[model samples]
Target: MREVAIVAFGQSDHVRDSAQTSEVEMLMPVLHDVLRRTGLRTRDIGFTCSGSSDYLAGRAFSFTMALDGVGAWPPISESHVETDGAWALYEAWVKLLTGEADTALVYAYGKSSPGDLREVLTRQLDPYYLAPLWPDSVALAALQAQALIDAGRTDEAELAAIADRDRTAAAAHPHAQRRGPRPAGEYVVAPLRTGDCPPIGDGAAAVILAAGDTARRLAAAQGRRPAWIRGLDHRIEAHSLGVRDLTDSPSTRLAAERAGVFRRPVDTAELHAPFTSQEVVLRDALALDDTVRINPSGGAQAANPVMATGLIRLGEAADRIQRGDSDRALAHATSGPCLQQNLVAVLEGEA
Candidate 1:
């Protein structure tokens, strides 16, 4: 496989709603910023892939319309996923490894405020059983939280502390939607408070991936180190929530192992645990120690923009490495109810 590195990343200001802005409008700035930072023009990109959902846009082929932001006039090799942008990044990496593309542009965006996001997410559940019940995202996450409590994996106070810490860290992130200190509020769903759940937001993010010498040149021009992808893998579990253990994430553990997360010491991790209790499960699954810094950019708990949130985790971890803040890091992304699917990537700075 070819060595791949994230050379540039850019994101929009995460907000509760973008009633005045279209998805294309939200993406243009981020896309331009990423391309500009890499000193690459749209014509120079070998491949372009995006992540977005027509369900959120309330129309079919919504991503096709978003192509305007990337300027598809000259006709570029493009693809898209209905999943998070982190998965899109994985696809781009695969393309580079195949020697079909040496440089790729990846982006993801979501507008969750247009509809009842909690209700909308329930559609992703098992159609025969869980979908009929129409359990909102918060309620489903609360069920997982309660399971953790019952299994003695975590407590309410610990969950609150996690929420408190994440919100505090979010204060420094200009693009973070939720910031400042937050008192764990009354349960929106039993065992899950307002703070325990992620704030629904609208946002977009873009990343530029370059292989080998191109990556080195980009990093040098930017006067920073490249965050080389050491290992990358994803795994999925049973779709039926009833058959799965909510307090443990076997999928994450498998993905982490495949991604070489435990092969060496990690200095930081950016995890896509939207719910506070889910963070506890992921930490155990990844076997992260107290010495490893977690979610310094606040994580999805502070500002989750659905399809784009997972990609933000990867970008944040890479940014930390590029800035010389950490030598090695782990970036994780999750999908489906109770983390049924997971992607893990291990990144290391220049040796």
Candidate 2:
């Protein structure tokens, strides 16, 4: 595979609602900002990809409408996914590896406030067994949290501590929807408190990638370091939550191994764990220790925008390396209910 690096990242301010802003309106500035930061124009990009959901938009081909924001007038090679933006990044990386594109742009957004997000998420589950039950996203996650508690792997207090730490860290992120730690309270769902859950929000994130020499030149011209992609891999588990071990993330473990996460010590990790319990599962799956900082941007629990949350994890991890704050970092993204799918990427800065 050809070497690829993240050259620029941009995000919209996360909020519970964007009452007046259309999806294109929400995306335009973010798309422009990333291009501006990279000192590149839309025409310079060899490929463009995006991630979004029709369910969230309450319309089909919602991503097609977003193309207007990118100025598709001149016509650009683009593709989109129904999954998280991180997966879209994966697709762009593959294009680079094939030598089809030297530079690619990836972005994802979620305007979840327009509809019932819980009900919308249920559409992704098995229609016969899970969808008919309408368990909602939080309830499904609560089941996993309960299983972890019952197995003695974690407890409510520990979960609360994780929330406290993440929310506190979010206080520094201007784009985060929720910030400041509060005491964990009575369960929203058994064994899961409000703090244990992510704040539902509307947001967007974009990342720019360049392969090999293009990456080096871009970094030099921008006077910034590039987060080189050393390893990237993804894995999936059984779709049925009942058949899987809720407390252990075998898929995440496998992806981490394939992504070479344990090859060297990492200074930081930005995990797309929407819930506190999920964070615990990921930390163990990745074999990260106390020495490694986790979720310095507060993670999804602080501000989750569904499709965009996972990509934000990649952006946050890369930002740390680009800023010279860390030499090695790990970014994780997840999809499907109860952590059924996971993507892991290891990034390193120039020595």
Candidate 3:
């Protein structure tokens, strides 16, 4: 396989809400930052892929407005996904692998505050059986938490510890939505509490990927180190909640192996675990231990803008490599209920 590396990455400040700004307005500055960092303009990109949902904006073709942020007056080759920005990166990787494009731009954004975010998320479930019940995301996650406790895999204190560690790490992230000292306390829903939940927030992010000679050229021109993608893979598990084991994330385990997560001891990991309990499941499935620094960017517990959360994981993991923070890292993203769909990527500085 041809090597593909992330040459540049940029993200906007994650806010509780962008009162006066539209998604396009929020994206424009970050897009400009990406170009500035890479020493490349819109014209230099060979392919563009974006991840955002129409439901986020409560309107169809919401991504069209975001195109304005890219300055598409002359038009550019582009595609989009209804999934997280990580999926867009997956699409971009495929484009590069096909020899169709050497350089690609991937981005995602969401303003979940405009509507009932939890209620909206239920739409992601099975329309026939799951959707009719209208179970909110946290309630489903609570079920997972309860199952873990029942199975003796973990307890409430462990969930609190996960929350404490992630939010404590967020102290270093200027873009994090929630960061402060907290006493790990009682459960908001029997064994899960406010601290165990990620705050609802609005955010956007963009990343630039280049492969082979083009990647080298871009790195040289920008005087920036590149985070090479050592391996990337994703997997999906059975959707029926009752049919699958909630305590284990089989998809994540498979995806991690396929992504070569164990090839070289990972120094750090950025996991997209929105709820505190989900982090436990992911950590166990990925076999990450104390040696692996988890969520240095504070992770989803800090700022989770739905579709944008996964891409943020990739960007943050790359940032550590670009900044010379670590030699090897893993970036993981999860979607659907009880971690139904998952992606894992092993990254390192170009050797």
Candidate 4:
């Protein structure tokens, strides 16, 4: 298999509203920033992929307009996933492996504040049973939290601690929406609290991937270190809540093992734990220890723009490697209720 490395990454500042800008407008700066970092233009990319949901925007083909952000005048080879952006990254990586495209551009975005996010998420559940109940995302996560508490995997204080640390970390991130000190007290559900939930926000992110000599050239031009993607894989689990175990993410376990997450000690890890309780599930499923630095980017708990959040995790992990801060890292992304579907990517700095 051919090797692929992330040469550059960029994102828009996470915000609550973009009254003056469309999604394409929001993505233009990010796309330009990524291209500037690599000294490459849109025409230089061999392939382009995006992740987004039409349902989130209450419209179809929301990604079509966002293509303007990539300057599609000459038209570029592209694809999109209705799933999270991490899946789009997976598709792009596969395209690289085919020995076709030497470089690829991957991005994702969502303006989740446009609708009642809680009610919108209900559509993700089983239409006949769960959807009819209108089970919102936070409610499903709360169920997982209760199960974790019952299994003694976490307590109120642990959830608070995760929220505190993640918020503190977000303070350093210029694009992070939920930063600053959050009082770790009380519960929004029972174990989860208002402080623990991720902020609903709007944002876009882009990453450039290159292989072999092209990758080396781009890395040199950017004056940035490359984070080589060692292995990447994703898996999905049964969606039925009654039949599935909410306490552990079997999909994550499967994807991590496939991605070789345990091959070596990860200097840092970026897990996409949307809610505080999901953190426990991902931690156990990925087998990350205390030595692993988790969510240094504040993860989804800081600002989750739906389809974009997971891919942002990958970009954040790559950023750590590019900055000479990490030698080995793991980036994770999850979708579906209670972490039903998961993706894991193992990354390391190239010599």
lDDT of each: 0.92, 0.92, 0.88, 0.88
Write one digit per residue (lDDT tens) for candidate 3, span 1-351.
888988888888888888789998998898988888788889889899999998878899989989987767788989999989999999999899888998999999988889888889999999999999998888889899999999998998788888888888988788888885477655656667888878887889999999988887877777767889998999999979989889999999999999998777899999999898998899999999899999998999889988999999999999889878977989998888878899999999866
Deviation (Å) of 141 in candidate 3: 0.4
Determine which window of 10 residues in candidate 3 has minimal summed lDDT. 180-189
Order the candidate numbers by lDDT, best to worst: 1, 2, 3, 4
Encode model 1's per-residue lDDT on 6-108: one tens digit a residue. 9998999999999899999999999999888889999899999999888787788989888998889868899999999999999999999898998999999
> After superposing candidate 2, which stretches have Cα over 4 Å from the reference?
none
State the lDDT of candidate 4 residue by residue for 267-293, as single tens digits: 899989899888988989988889999
List candidate 3 stretches off by more than 4 Å: none
The TM-scores of all predictions, comma-separated, are: 0.99, 0.98, 0.97, 0.98
Better of 2 and 3 by TM-score: 2
Better of 1 and 3 by TM-score: 1
Whichever of 3 and 4 has more lDDT, that candidate is 3
Cand. 1 Cα-lDDT: 0.92
Tens digit of lDDT per residue, candidate 2, span 1-351?
A: 789999889999999999899999999999999899888899999999999999998999888889998878778899999999999999999999899999999999999999999889999999998899898898999999999999998998899999999999999989989989987877888878888989988999999999998988887777889899998999999877889999999999899999899888899999998889999899999999999999999999778998999999999998888888989999999998889899999999987
